[model samples]
Target chain A: QQQVKQSPQSLIVQKGGISIINCAYENTAFDYFPWYQQFPGKGPALLIAIRPDVSEKKEGRFTISFNKSAKQFSLHIMDSQPGDSATYFCAATVWGNTGKLIFGQGTTLQVKP
Target chain B: GAGVSQTPSNKVTEKGKYVELRCDPISGHTALYWYRQSLGQGPEFLIYFQGTGAADDSGLPNDRFFAVRPEGSVSTLKIQRTERGDSAVYLCASSLNGRSSYEQYFGPGTRLTVT
Candidate 1:
């Protein structure tokens, strides 16, 4: 019930195209959701985050869409570039629970030049 | 300003040996966390500390895994009787104190290889 399942073990997108990754969860208690980007040999960095109060949140070229009813969320990348290629992970945590994150299986995204 | 820094970028040990990994959080950050990431997978939380005491450690895999933050600045994760399955990249992160403290900054991580 604590698991955050992510789809598309790997994705390849062309430059200037749209890239999308999906995730689903069973726990409804999770009020905070965040996406992280990790490059080779680097720790995962927070990219964008959203709370259950809002349906969507956008930060520059990255956007997160959330569906409270479906227990699902997704990350969209506009104008995909090679520099955006990396491993992306979706995570969830119940606020005030020590901020221990439950992460989904990562998605390896490759943007072709 | 420096981000979280971890010592011993890499460590290799034989089965049954013990090892300790260290983390130095950013200055004035009162919250610290430790996580372990296996190859091709996302990280899993291991423990959390607020000040000099461990606030939560339910994510710790077993008694063989222990951590301590005696001075509220640096923390050490100790693994006893290390097994080959224990090999993974151990990550450390820190954030400010508040309800919005979830915005953590992570370190480069220390990769442990148990043979």
Candidate 2:
């Protein structure tokens, strides 16, 4: 089963605008949720993460809004720039428990200037 | 001192050939993971290792796929009788914790093409 599900297989946003992506998880055991950003020819890198304890987390221009009841979370990029054009993947795992991650299908975002 | 690294960034082999992909994790990291990403899909978990032993191998596709972490710091994934469907980017990751809150650092995946 796909533990996490993501939407918008591809997206196009204008520079200086907001780029948003959403994900849902079915595994209640997942306590740690993280989003990764990947560029062409490179592996993914951690972007932002959130725990169920918090409703939301903001780091710089990136924000992760999580809802425990809804089993949903989203990544928002403020003032999205062309440099932000890349593939984004949302993942869930029960950290300190098992290193296995359930990754979403991924969203290919294009921020146009 | 560095991120995870995968050897033979690209490999092309004939069908039915055997191939092995290697991974080197960051210094001090104790957990390692293997995943495969097809052309347009997200990565699929394959196996996981903690210390020098495998904690999980349920994701492995079949008996033909095997992995080992002899020393716990590095790993190798071996595939026998490679099939065309096996072509994909295989990724390796490392984390400080075997199963907890630490972020997993990824390596530039090795693109394996079985022709």
Candidate 3:
């Protein structure tokens, strides 16, 4: 029940296109969902996050669409650029639970030039 | 300001050897966490520290894995009788507090290769 499953193990999109990655979880206790971006030989960096209270949250070119009933969320990158090419992970954790994160399998996004 | 910093960018050890990885979180950050990421996978939580005490350690895989934050500033992850399966990138992160509202800043991570 602690697992956050992500889909599309790998994706390739051209520059100026939109890139989407999906994730689902079974734990309803999770109230905070965050997406991280990682580059080769680097640690994962926080990209954006959302709460179940809102259906969607947008930050700059990155948007997180969340569905509380389905226990699913997705990350969308508008105008995908080569710099956005990296491994993306979706994670969930319960609020006020010491912030222990359960992460997805990760999706490798490749933005073609 | 510096982000979380980890020492020994890479370490190679033989099976049964013990190793220690260190982490220095951002100044004044009160929450620290440890995670391990295997090849092509996301990081798996290992432990969390709020101040000098471990708040959550259920994610630790086994007794061979232990972490300590003696001074509430620097932290260390110790692995005993390491096996080849222990090879992975060990990550350390910290936030202002253990609250979900605060952002957790991550370190570059230390790669451990057990042969």
Q: For each candidate, how many residue pairs have backbone atoms clashing (under 3 Å)?
A: 0, 6, 0
Q: Pick the candidate with the highest lDDT.
A: 3
- Model 2, A11-91: lDDT tens digits are 999999999999999888888999999998899899998989999999999999999999999999999999999999999
The DockQ of each candidate is 0.72, 0.79, 0.82
Which of candidates 1 and 3 reaches a greater DockQ? 3
- lDDT winner between 1 and 3, please give it: 3
Query: Would you list the rank order by TM-score, best first?
Result: 3, 1, 2
TM-score between predicted and true chain B, model 3: 0.98
Clashing pairs in 2: A95-B99, A95-B100, A96-B99, A96-B100, A97-B99, A98-B99
User: How high is each candidate's TM-score?
Assistant: 0.98, 0.97, 0.99
lDDT of prediction 3: 0.95
Where does model 1 exceed 4 Å of error?
Answer: none
Superpose all Cα atoms of candidate 1 onto the true structure and report the RMSD in Å to 1 decimal.
Answer: 0.9
- lDDT for position A39 in model 2: 94
Write one digit per residue (lDDT tens) for candidate 3, span B9-110. Answer: 999999999999999999999999999999999999999999999999999999999999999999999999999999999999999988744478899999
lDDT of 2 by residue, B1-115 (tens): 6779999999999999999999999988899999999987888999999989989999999999999999888899999999999999999999887755368899999999998
- lDDT of each model, Cα atoms only? 0.94, 0.92, 0.95
Model 3 Cα lDDT, one tens digit per residue, A20-44: 9999999999999999999998889
